[model samples]
Target: MAIKHILKLLLQQKGISLLIILQVAITVMIVSNTAFISYATLQNWLIPSKLEENQILNVTTRVFDNNIDIASLIEQDVQAIEAVPGVIAASYASHELVLDSQGPGWTMFKDTQPETDYRVFGYFGLDEKGIDVLGLKVIAGRRFYPSEYIKGSFQSNNAGVIMISEELSEALFGNGSALGQTVYISRQRIPHRVVGVYQGKMLGESATYSQQQYHSGIVPEVLWGNRQKLNYLVRVAEGVPERVLQQVETALYHTPGRMVQRVEYAARAKKRLWDGRSTFAFTMSGISLIACIVTAMGIIALVSFSVSLRKKDHGVLRALGASRSMVMTTLIKENTILVFIGLVLGFPLAILLYYFLMNNVHVQSVVELPLLVAVALFTWLISTLAVYLPAREAAKVSPAQVTKSS
Candidate 1:
């Protein structure tokens, strides 16, 4: 009987009810999706770089005159940077952090079959000391023998020895050991033997969806010559002062045939790379908060207005025998029905929006059914609470009031 009466009341006030339902629907769609996106981004952001980020510095230099003896200069610079009080170790690298930029890659295949499976991998050209410089753990085989280390640029070294990441190891050789296995670099017939396998090293952009991000190989070679830039990977000792970077920079400026381009901290480089995702998280958080607030306020306003207009009806019911608790329950039930209607519409809209985002932006906007149910229940509870005061006021109206008005 109460439900029928509430249904009639809702049918009479179509405009206000529709407006409130629309507000709830919009809130549900935006708040739920935004929350999921923000959380996903934050989770991705927290993934460890697996490097000594705080203790490492990348000091890049440009050679003004390519004619200078590149190998000698880099060797001297390494010695100088290592001599610093807080310096742990330093080495010359073609690149710094793996996440900073996509490095050199080669498409490799296990067989000569026409439809053979192949994988692309980014190679890091580093000297024997390079593994220690990046703090990479060689879990299998052995590090590059000092004999394997060559003194020329990557192209000229043509070194046939390389270190592979564990992921690449599993991909190429499966469960069996990858050590002593020879894999070809690209289409070239020459084979480079896998000398070592390291853990916790990543290549390219970790946040990207590329399969080759963690597929890394380290070539035991140094880059030297009329190169435009020289990359020095340096690791500082524990409790090193910030002044160590400036000191390192000053030392490089004194080196002949080179100009200091920039002394970059690994942590700073990572921050610059990840700033975009951080900004997106913050933006979505703000949007979700505003949507929730607007929806809550809309619920309050609509319920209050309905109660005000139905004062006479509430009075008539109270006079006939409806208790205060009964009047409040009826009003709450009415608001819950409206909320349910909005949720029914909002769920489909949310799914469509998620699909739109996934297709357009390529984000992993997977909608969990349990999350949807929780959001619905939460909104229903809050809407009922928002209507509580208005319901109480309606219940407080005396039967004599309607009698007096009539």
Candidate 2:
């Protein structure tokens, strides 16, 4: 048959064509939503940190590392680690070095800007030695003056000075020198001057781009070393043996009254964030599957109904000597064309839902092309499965049984 004949037949059988198209459209919608949500979860699991892996081990002390008098003890412990052979950089950080709530950062406004809903900058109390250990780079302005380290006067020095990452600068002030401008920091109406801006050392990169999308486009982890903070981390030298790690662990074990029983990092980045995300993704997948199944069932029923209505026409074609294979192939070609038409219409809408709309709500990561291809293939598969049974039944029609006697 020519193109006109096929199109004319499709136009005549509008009800069946429309039913298949609608089912495909629903399948595409559900698949795109599921993909967008899945990727969003993956992005949050791996947050970025600048800590040098391979060389780093985070050590905790049950002792009063946070005690005021224990500040001297904490500094002494770090100095002792400095004496250890092959120990390159050892630093003490308050809560800043760890992730999630252990090192939370915020951006408080000078005068709260309702339009700009921002959090405050994270605080770090780094001694000169600890500063270099963290390896933070200055993009603009200078490091903290020594006078700022004095226990009492230190608060005065810190009251006005603030240091932050380049990402944060762009998030708050568009573009320009972030220096010299005083930014507000929460309920206190207190202002901290933007003394410097810096970039974080690339950390946790291995977690981001694995076979899974974990750490891509995550927020930079802020590193602040406070002497009073017990949550200290150390980066050992290369070629160092397990004996060295044992010695460090031994040092903690033999430290006077308190004991250091455990030291470990979470295998994955942020557990709670990704855990909730995974649950959400699984739920969406279930919903998507159900929607696709419902659509497939509807398409099959509608197509079967249409095939029954047009049974007499197929009988006429069979009387004209069209072989069973030829008749079956024609039906397959017709339905496949309807599917293609549905795809052309459904795909663009799926893309819009997955990208522009879904990412904004999820705040995870933006969905990309690979996800798009997955959704399209899934939608096509469901639609294809729906027409299979109808196609097989159409192929089994008999001409002589329907013909009238002359």
Candidate 3:
């Protein structure tokens, strides 16, 4: 009966009811999508590289003299770095350190091709000690053999043995064994045997490649070319990375014809990589919070205005028989109905907005059902609270007040 009366009242003020409903629908659409983006960005920021990041350092060096033997200089630098106290191991690679945000070197590989059955992956060349320096765990196969190590330029494709991440293993070969299988790389279709599979969650050159973060492959090769700088990944003893960082530059200076460009802890570099995205996620969360507050304020003001207009009806109800609690409950139920209708309309709008973001923006997560349900319940809770104070004030209206007004 109260619902029927409330529906009649809402019909009499169609413009106000529709306005509140539209406000709620817009709020729900904006808040939910922004909240989802924030959640996904934070999730990406927390992904582990599966490396001994705290105890590892990346040392970048530039070779300026053309006459020096770059490969021999690299070997000498490696020896000197390893001899430093607290240093465990070090290896040179073609690319910058993992999580440096320099972007990835992408290439295509295939198990068997009708010329189209191929998948793309980011790759970098590493020496035999690269696995140990990066702290990768070999789960299904062996690490690169010492004899497989080679010295080559960045574009050199002469590696005969390749080690892939477990994610790539599942992507290319499914449940079957990837060991000893011949997969072709790049457009030249050069075939290399998969010698090993290791486990790591290292990001592909940048964090933007969300799907390809773990789709990495390492070859048993070290890079040296004209005007190309060298990147050395060093693993140190626990509790001594900072001490070892101080010594790496001096050790590298022992070898002439090159300059130590930079030496930094891998953990610090990884933080720098994700810092921008983390800030963006936090900013979005703040915006969503403000939107929720504004929506709640709107609901409160609308309900208060409606209660002021309905004081006479509330007074007559109390004069007849209705208790204070009954009046409050009826008012709350009416607002709840309005909120429910708004949610019904807002759900589709939220989905459309999500689709627009996925198509036009770089949203990384899919729509989650539980998150949507939670948003709905939260909206309902906010509306209930917003209605409470106004309803309480209206319920205080007595029979004497109605008589005096009349």
Instruction: Identify the candidate with maximal lDDT.
Output: 3
Output the better candidate (2/3) by TM-score: 3
Which residue pairs show backbone clashes in model 3? none
Best by TM-score: 3
Q: Write down the worst ten-residue block by lDDT for model 1.
A: 204-213
Which window of 10 residues has the lowest lDDT sum in candidate 2?
A: 212-221
TM-score to true structure, per model: 0.74, 0.65, 0.82
Tally clashes: model 3: 0
State the lDDT of candidate 1 residue by residue for 57-91, as single tens digits: 88889988867877778889999999988898998
Error of 3 at 244 (Å): 1.5
**What C-alpha lDDT values do all the predictions have?**
0.77, 0.61, 0.78
RMSD of each: 4.9, 6.6, 3.8
The residue pairs in collision within model 1 are none
Q: Local error of candidate 2 at 404, Å?
A: 8.7
Q: lDDT for model 1, on a 0 to 1 scale?
A: 0.77
